[model samples]
Target: MTTLTTTRGDITTEHVDVVVNAANNAMRGGGGVDGAIHRAGGPDILRDCITRFPDGLATGDAGWTTAGRLPARWVVHTVGPNHGAGQRDRGLLESCYRRSLEVADELGARSVAFPLISAGVYAWPRRQAVTVAIDTIATTPTKVEEVRLVAYDAGVHQEIASSLTMATSVRILQGVRALHRRGYHGLRVNPGVAPSGLFWRVVLTDAADPGSSVRYTSADEAKFAGGVVDAMTTPHEVAEQILRALPRLRPANDAPAYAAWFAGLLAAVEPEHALPVSSADYFDDTDGWEIGWNSGLRYPAPPLDADSSQ
Candidate 1:
C-alpha cells in the first residue's frame, strides 16, 4: 500500500527518489517551483532539458531531467493546466499527476515528492488544486511506496491537512457502514463531535441508550471498552473500535459469514462516500422500514427515536 502525507518545505530539498516540478509548457523553467528548481539544480538541468525536450512539453504532460545539484536523483517536470487562461478542464490537471507517476514508475522511484501544481502563477484555485493532487495521487496505482505533497507555506500546509482529514472522515464513515452490514447493532452518529466541515464522529453503542461512553477528544484519550485500541484521528481506529465491540454485540458463530457480508457491503459503495446519505439521515425515511443496505438487501433498520441520546 502507498502512504500519502503532506509537509511544509521546499520541494527541491526533499530527499526522495523523485521530485516533481510545476513547470510551464516551455520547460525552460519559469516562476514558482520551476524557477526555484532550476536555480537550485544549476545549469545541468537546463542543458538536459534542451537536449531531451528541445520543442518543450504540452500541458498535463511530464518528462524528467538530471537533478543537477538537488538532493533527489531525478526531477520529473510536468506542465499544469493554466486555469487563468480559461483552461479549466479538470482532466488536464489530473493528467499532470497521473503522467508524473507513470514517469516515476518507469524510473523505478520508490518515493516521490510533489508541489501543489497550478496553484501559483497558473491561477488554479488552491483548494481545488490540493483536492485534485491528493485525490489523484491517492487513487493512482504505482510501485512508489511513499508520496509527499509539499506545501511552501504554513497556510497551504494547513489547507492540505484539512483536505486529508476530510478524506479520512469519509473512509471512517465507510467503515461504519461495513460494521453495520455485519449485524453489529447499536451504531450511532456523534454529530456534535465536529463543529465544522465534514468531520463527524461515529459511535458503536452497547444498548439503545449507551450506559457508558468512550469520549475521543484527543489521541491520548482514545479508548475502546476500557482498553486502548487506536488513535481516534485515524481510520484504522474506527475499524478497530468496531471489531473490538463485535463480540459483545453479537455471537461469534459464523463470524466469517458476517465478515463476508461486510466486505460485500463495502464493495457495493464505490468511491468511498458516494452513497449521498449520512448516518443522521438514515432514519428520516417515513416508511418505517429502514433504508436497505444496498439494492439487494433490505434488513429492518433499528429504531431512530433513540438517536437523541448521542
Candidate 2:
C-alpha cells in the first residue's frame, strides 16, 4: 500500500526520495511548477535535462534528473497535457503520475511528493486534478512507499483531503483493544501522522518514565500482557486495515485518562468470548467512538462522526 498524504506546504522544502515536476514538453524550465523546480533545484537540474534529453521529452512521459539544491535525491519531470491548449486527453494527464512513479521505481525511490499537474497555468480544473492525482497514484503498481500531494495552499489542501474517504478511527481503536505481540506492556492511543500515514500512533511499552512508570506497586515490578501491535509488522497496510484506521479517531487520552480506559476494558474482557468495551455512560463527549456495545447499557445519545465535525 502506497500511503497517500495530502498537505498544504512548499514542495521545494519536502524531504523525500523524489519530487515530481510538472514540466512542459520542451523539458526546458518555464513557468509554474516547471520554473519553481528549476529555480530551487539550481542549474544542475536543467543541465541534466539538456544532457539527458537533447531532443526534449514527449508529453505524458517522465524521466529523472539530479535534485541539485533541493532536499530530494532526484526529480521526476513529466509533461502534463495542456488542457488550455485543447489538449484535453485525461489519459495524458494520468500518464504524468503513472510515468513519474515508473521513473521513481527505476530510481529506487520510496517516497515522492507531487504538485497538482496542469491545475495551474495549464488550466486543468483544480478539483479534477486532485482526483486524477489520487486515482492515478492509488491504482498504479510500484515499489514506492509513500506519495504526498503537496497542495499550494489551504484551499487546495482541503480539496485534496475532502476528496479522500475519511479513514474510520473507531475501527483502529478496536484493533488496538486486541493487544498481543511479545513484550509485556500498556497502550497509548495517539493521533498523528506516521510514515505509513496513520493519524494514530499506538504506543506499547514498559519504559519507566513520568507518563509510563506507574504500572507496578513496587519500583521494579510491571503489569499486563506484553506485546507490540503486530498489525504494523506488515508493510503498506491501508488506513482501514490500519489497526483498522482513519475515522475521526479521538480515543480517550492516555495520560491521566489511560487508567480509566484500561480498567474498564479489563473488566469487560473478563467475560468469556467478549471483546472489551468502555462504560458508555463514562464517555460523555470525550471519544467519538460508538457509545455502547453491551445490550444492557443505556443509549446515551447520537453517535458522533469524528471527521465531519472537523
Clashes of each: 0, 11
TM-scores of all candidate predictions against the true structure? 0.65, 0.55
Q: Write the per-residue lDDT of candidate 2 for residues 1-310, one digit (tens) a residue.
A: 6788787888988999999999987888999878989999999999999999888988899999999999999999999988899998889999999999999999999999999898888998775687678767866888999889898778988977755432222223443443312111233433222343322223333222324321111111111122122211222222223322222333333233343454454333222112222222343333432222333432222223212322
Residue pairs with backbone atoms closer than 3 Å in model 1 (clashes): none
Candidate 2, which ten residues in sequence have the lowest lDDT sum? Answer: 214-223
Judged by lDDT, which candidate is best? 1
Q: How accurate is candidate 2 locally (lDDT)?
A: 0.62
Candidate 1 lDDT at 62 equals: 96
TM-score attained by model 1: 0.65
